[model samples]
Target: MSQVLSVNVGAGADKPYAKVRLTGIDKRPADGPVAVRAPGPKRGVSGVAGDFIGDERHHGGDRQAVYAFQREDLDRWQGELGRDLPNGCFGENLTTVGIDLEQVLVGERWTVGDPADGEALELEVTDPRIPCRTFSGFLAERGWVKRFTADARPGTYLSVVRPGQVRAGDEVRRTFVPDHDVTIGLLFRATTTQRELLPRLLVARDYLDAETRSLVERRETFTLDDA
Candidate 1:
């Protein structure tokens, strides 16, 4: 029964992020309430469906994003870094209330909207965000992004399953969609060190994207035993 405490968009109004500076702004998930939606015609990522809130240039990577987190992570980080900068400095899109960051796995579903609006939106949790130089710059720590990324405990990326509008203070409820199915987690595992799990993950092929699907297919075709 998690609710969207806040739905934040962009880095900041005054300083909307560009490719380069998008890295500097500490885009923390808001702890209030906000509205969300599939960006409209003017907002489409270079003009396409299912392309909202991310860099259009990089379709399959870390763009169209959302985040769910526990307040405890913020509290812990605040003690460590809040003294010098704003709290929750990572600039996440959605700051979730009562959602456990660790528990929001890939394939999870979140229903979010105001009941009166009759516009509930379901978002499927995708992959864990990989840390980048921007994250390091914001925290002023050399590898805070890696620290969060290594554990794969960072909040999740969401793909819009059912597109609609979300407003600040709108209620968001997340339902675990069942981990028994194949998921983005398995994809990440297959791509990385967990090569042994790749075959098992392939059984869940429908979940794979064009980019990842191609990579996995190529890998399977190769005879790794000799190489």
Candidate 2:
């Protein structure tokens, strides 16, 4: 059975772009259950109510509202780095156990608890998170972003279906699985260094986030123009 191991959130603060100083990336697990609601277009359309997103242009939105990572993956990284990897270390709101997020298809839906409340707290898997300079700086490791990307374990992003409270140890179940080949890892590779797979993203056109859809369309057009 899959469940949330941690529920984490953070507040916004000033940070020197060149130096790390309390950025939201260092999220700590919530002391208890935390309220999570979609901040709709009127309210930044990205993070939940209590969370802070440092970059407006790249972070947060309907498609990237919540970030989730596999706790088991973190454990492995901890061993590799000889460090303590706490929940939300990578800024994920929910750290899950027994969930294989890598192969999750775009548009797959998950309910964290009571189908009723979870109906609102429902989360639809969207895209793979692309780590940024902020992440690299936060970890204080050289080529952190490159290393993470190369590992191809970038966690998945999710869109809120129903807004409600989420806490650690909530039951997690896959409510729906879309019929598509755009798994989180596949999509991540397609968008990043794998140019060969860009054209394949069109298979899940309607379900893909706008940015990715646009990328596929543009890539297709470019391919045709050259042919």
Candidate 3:
């Protein structure tokens, strides 16, 4: 029952957000159907073509090819923030509806659009996006990162599994869900200030993003016997 409410991409350029400066966060809805392809792990770049990124070191790559935010969640924030939130305002490439981020598992798969219409655009949930200083600045929100982290709804990053065309209103169907308790909210907690949860990420070893997996495995100074 999940569906894409909008598809957005931005022209990358250096821009100012609050006191923090960054680029490629301002996205507008796509004019029409846009090709959705894997940005590839080769070097991680922006997901949508024509969207520029100034932070090559952190933003894009194969593992984080796409970013998605729930329209429902946005609506909630809009009410709380007392501001209207438009699609793509959060820098998400896909604004989705009906997908529960709190329950989303890493390595889950979603098929966007109908295959019969030659639109089997595929995406795999990779990890939850960590809010950055730039994000806080963009929202002009005071302590936004902490607020976002506390909310435990950082949205989700994805990789293109089968690249194709995706457009607004396309149906997003959950094609696969990993059998793990590593939901997006849990993963976000583990990767953020909640370092204690890092060990729990090991449970979804196959699905954990490389960075998270490394953090979990690399931090284990004690051997299994020591535990």
Candidate 4:
């Protein structure tokens, strides 16, 4: 069954590997339920209570309130890297199982936990998690950014549609799926290795985060200018 294998949160700490001297990328599994909600308009505010965001300019906000990574993908990476990567190793708030995150549509909505309990968390998939220098430094793997982008399973970033609480082992149910074909994988490729596919991402413009929307718009302008 599709469920949250673990809910993770990180405390802000100084790390030499981080571009910002301080980073919250070393997340650890939480012991109990964690509150989930939309972050403030400002950057670097995490949606999950007690969670920390390191980079104000590039991380967090309402559009990137939560991040999730699949256990299947983690296992695959573990095999390739020959190391033990536990839940939250990738700085994901939720470590999930039984969901193909890469194939999830950009606007797909998920109800996490039991709705009958009146505390189910509603999350909308907004964009793919792009690999950055922070992530590369965290892993200490050579050519990590290029390798991750090439692999194209960039995980998923989500916005909290309804504030609630989430815990490990909670069920995750897909309540809605957008009609567009802009999956997380497609969006990642479009913004990275496959610039030619950027035009196709316009079909799901309503679901894209601000950064992605701006990228598409800039690309469109560039195309028109060259024409």
Clashing pairs in model 3?
A: 12-52, 40-62, 44-60, 44-61
Q: Model 2: how far is 224 from its true place, Å?
A: 4.3
Q: Is candidate 1 or candidate 2 better by lDDT?
A: 2
TM-score-better candidate, 2 vs 4: 4
Which one wins by lDDT: 1 or 4?
4
Sequence-dependent TM-score of model 3: 0.91
C-alpha displacement of 48 in model 2, angstroms? 2.7
Cα lDDT of model 2 by residue, 1-227, tens digit = 89999988877766665233435676888877677766664423445557877666667777788899999899998998889989999879899999888888888898887666624468899889998888887777888889999989899988888777678889888989877778999899999979779998898898886667899999999999999
Quote the positional error of residue 106 for candidate 3 in Å: 0.2
Highest-scoring model, lDDT: 4
Per-residue lDDT of model 1, residues 3-50, tens digit only: 655454443222233344223234443443343443422322311122
| Clash counts for all predictions | 13, 5, 4, 0
Give stretches of model 2 more than 4 Å off. Answer: 17-22, 42-46, 116-120, 224-227
How far is 216's C-alpha from truth in model 2 (Å)?
0.8
Error of 1 at 123 (Å): 1.5
Writing each residue's lDDT as its tens digit, candidate 4 over 35-127 gives 999997788999999999989988999878999999999999999999999999999999999999999999899999996866678999987
What lDDT score belongs to each candidate, Candidate 1 first? 0.52, 0.81, 0.82, 0.92
Return the TM-score for each candidate structure.
Answer: 0.67, 0.91, 0.91, 0.95
Residue lDDT tens for model 3, 1-227: 78999999887556666222448788889878888787777553866676656677787888788899999999999999999999999989899998887778888898899957555888898888888887887888899989988998889988888888888999988889777778888888877878877778887988876666778887665435477
Regions of candidate 4 where Cα sits further than 4 Å from its true position: 218-227
lDDT at position 210, candidate 1: 58
Clashing pairs in 2: 45-61, 46-61, 120-162, 120-163, 121-162
